[model samples]
Target: MNSLRKEPLGGGSSEPLPVAIIGNGPSGICLSYLLSGNTPYVKSHAVHPHPLLQRKLMETPGVSIMDQDLDYLSEGLEGRCESPVALLFDALLRPDTDFGGDMESVLTWKHEKERTVPHVVLGRNLPGGAWHSIDGSMVTLSQGQWMGLPDLQVKDWMRKKRRGLRNSRATAGDIAHYYRDYVTKKGLEHNFVSGAVVTAVKWEGLEPQDSGAQDSRPLFQVSGFLQNAQDPSPQPFILRARNLVLATGTYDSPARLGVPGESLPFVHHELAALEAAMRAGTVTPASEPVLIVGAGLSAADAVLYARHCNVPVIHAFRRSVDDPGLVFNQLPKMLYPEYHKVHQMMRDQSFLSPGPYEGYLSLPQHQLLLLKEDCQAVFRDPRGGQKAFGVSLVLVLIGSYPDLSFLPGGGALLTMDPSQPLSAKRNPIHVDPFTYQSTHQEGLYALGPLAGDNFVRFVQGGALAAASSLLRKETRKPP
Candidate 1:
C-alpha cells in the first residue's frame, strides 16, 4: 500500500490512475487517507450522544464507515441546507460540538493493503491548499479543533512541532502548517501533485480494448499546468482518470465589484495582500484611510486589522446593520468580539471615534461607484448623496465562488441548474447524499464546498461517502 499500484502502458509509462482527485485541500487529503488502505472501524464501547448511532455501531460486529448505512445515521440530525453525510461524520468524529467534547476519536484506523485504491491528488496549491495563502496572523472563523483531518489531531501536530498552543484558538499559520505537514507525516505526499492548475476535464469516452487495467477505463481527460518552483513557468500535462472527484473548493476565484478602477494598482481582493502591505510598512497611520468594501467576515477582518494598526478606515457595504440577513448580525458577540465591535460601529455610525473603533467611518447601505486616479473612492450613500473619500488602499471582500470554467458549459451539466454556471454560492452541485456522486454524470463526484458541505469538520464525510460508493461499485464488478 506504500506504493500506488499502476499498470504500465505500451511505452513503459503508467496508465491513468484508477481515481483522480481534483484539489488537494482537506477533501482530497481525506480521500487520499481513506483510499490508501487506512480503513475506519467503530471503537468498541465508544461514548456517543446519539444512542441509535451508538447501538448501530456496537451491534454490527467489525462495522466499518464504508459499509455502514450513512442515510440512517444522517436522519433527524441534518439541517435544511446541510450535508447529511457531513453531520453523520461530525457525530462519529466529535460526538458533540465541533468546538470540543471529544478529546479522543470514537473510531480506529485499520490498515488493509488489499483495499488500497490507486489514486492521485491533483491540486493548484501546496498540500494545505488555500489555507496556506491566508494571512498567517488572522484566526479562523471556526476553532482549531474543527480544522484537523481524520487520524491526526491539530493539537498533537502542534506538539510535534514544539509549538505551545494553550487553547483551541489557532491562527491561520498554525492550521496551514499542520495541513502541509499532515501530507508527509501520513505518507500521502507521494500521491499529491502540488501546484497543478486543471484547465479542462472532458469525458474522453471508454478506454481502448487492448488496455491492461481492465476494471475501469479512463472516463475523464484532465488537462492542467504543473508549475515549476524554480522557473515559475507552468509545465502543461494531460491525464486520464477512471473516476474524477471535484474537491476543488470555492476560494480560488474572488467575486468582482464590476466597476471602474477595480483593476487599479491600489485596489486589492484578498486579505493576505493587505496583511503583506501592513508588514512592509506601506499602510500606516500617516497613510490615507483604507476603504473597506463588502458585508462579509473578510470585510470585518480588514476593519479589525486596520484599526489595530492605527490606520483609518472607511467601511462601505450594501446591507444595513439591523438587517437580519447580515452575517455580522447572526454571529454571537461572545465568540466573535472583534466582528461584534465592527457591527457595533456600523450600527452606531461610529465615525472619528477615539475608542475601539477610532477613526472608523461606517457607511451602511453604501455603494462604491468609482475609484479616481489619486486613490479617491466615490460612493453613493443611503440618502443618494455621492461622497468621496481619500484612501490609500481599497479592499473588496464581498465573497467568492468555485472557478469551474474547466468543465463544459461552465460545468452546467453537474449543477442543479443547467442554465447557469456551476457555483457553490448560487447552487451546489447535484449529488447523491450517500455516494456524493454527480447525479447528472456517472464516475464524476464532488466533495467539500462543491457538494454544499462547506465546514472543515464536514469535509471528511464527503470523502468517506465517495470512498464507500467507489468500494461498493468495485465489489459488485465482475471478475
Candidate 2:
C-alpha cells in the first residue's frame, strides 16, 4: 500500500493544479467527482486540501479536469435527467462525439422500438411439468458462481445481489445519473467533459515553486487528452497539475474474441449495441435458435434478454455437461443440506428438475444445451447454417480480454498482462488501504476493480474503494 505524498512540481506561478485522470469508468469518474467536491456517498471521508492550497493549485490557466463524457447521457431523453438518478445525465454524451463511432444511435433507436418485456420466466427453477404465465416465471438476472461455489441456485444467492432491493434494474448509467443529481441539489460545480477516450498518460515528476506568500512547496506537471484511436495523426491533450491521479479501469482495454469474422459488426465486445437492437425490435423474439458461447455473467444477461425478446436461446460452453452450472457452482450440495440431498439424488438419476431456463416451456420444443466445445474460431456455415433456419443471430458471449492498443505504442505506463492473471504482489500500483495512494507513485493512486486482487471484478467494489480513498484524502491533515 502506498502512502499519500504532496510535492511541488515547478511549472508556472498562479496556475491551478491540473489533474488528469485516465479512463472514464468508475475509478476515473470517482476521482473527477472528488476533485470537484461533489461525491455524496463518499465525500464525508476525504480530508479536503485547504481551500487556499486548492486555490493555488487552480491558479494555473493550464489546469483543467476531463472525464469521458462531454455531456450527460440524459441530455436528449424526456425523463432521463429528472429523478435523483437523472443527475448522472449531467454530462451524458454519445460515443460519436469524439470517437467517430455511431453505436449510440443504434442503441437509442432499439430502445424506442424494441418490444417491452416486463421480465422473463426462468425454466430452471420450476418443478417437472410446472407451468407458468409469461410474466410470472422467475428470470435469473444474476449468477452466483463468481462467489466460489457452483451449485448455488441463482435465486438463493444474496451476497451476489440484493434481488428484493428497490430498483432491481438500476445500472451503472442509473448510478451516474443519481450522482449528478446529488451534485445539482447541493449547488456544487459539476464540471465535466465527455465524448473522448484517453489514448495515453505522460507523468512528469514534481518540482519546487514559490506561492508568493513568502513560502512555496513542490508542484507537479501532468498532461494528457480525449481523442479518437482511428485518427492516423491525432492531437495530444495536455494538462499541468500539482498532484495527479490515474484511475483508468481494466475494461479500458476492450476484450477480444481472437476468432475469425470477429471483425464483423454483428459480433460485439460489449452489450450496448445488442441491447439497442433488442430495444429497437430489430432483433425480435421468435423460434429462431440463438447460440451464446461462454458461461460468465455477460452470457447469463444475454440469455435473459434473449428470453424476454421471445428468442429461443441455445447456450454452448466449453464446460462438460457434468460440469457445474452457476447454481451448482455457487451453492454446491455440501453447503446447503436440503439442496445437497436433492442435487445428489438428481445426480444419481442423471436427471434434474427444470429451473429458470427450462421453466420457460410455454412455447414448447425449445432447445438449450451445455456443450464442451472450444470456440476455436467463428465463421459462417457453408450454407449459412441456422441463419437460414431462422437463426437470426449467433451471439458469442465468450469473454473479452484487454486490448492495450489504445495505449500509446500499444502499451501502458504500467505493464501487467491482462491475458495472464497475477498473484496480487506482482500487480501494478500498490494502494494504501487507508489513503488509496500508490506507494510507488506519490501523487498517483488507483481504485476500482483494477486496484483490488479479488478474483471477481465488480463495479460496486470499485466505486466503494474509490469513495473510501477520496474520503481518506479529503480528511487527512497535511504534516
Best by lDDT: 1
lDDT of 1 at 277: 82
Per-residue CA lDDT of candidate 2, range 263-366, in tens? 55455555455566677766666534555555555555666666656776555444433455534345533334433432332233221234444313111111
Structure candidate 1, residue pairs in collision: none
TM-score of each model, paired residue for residue: 0.91, 0.49
Show model 2 residue runs off by greater than 4 Å: 1-18, 23-173, 186-188, 209-237, 276-282, 285-288, 320-328, 331-391, 400-429, 453-479
lDDT tens digits by residue: candidate 1, 1-479:
12212321111344666788888889999989888888888887676777777766766768687787888767777532377888888777777664436546788889888778877888777887888778778888877778889888887787888875534567888888898888988888778877777899899868653557665444788887777567566667777777899998999889899999999988999877777788899988889988899888899888888888888888899887789999887876777787888888877764323345557888888888999888999988888889888999999999898988899877777888877766776788999988999998888999989988887888888999999888765444221
Error of 1 at 411 (Å): 1.4
lDDT of 2 at 469: 46
Models, CA RMSD each: 3.6, 18.4
Top TM-score hit: 1
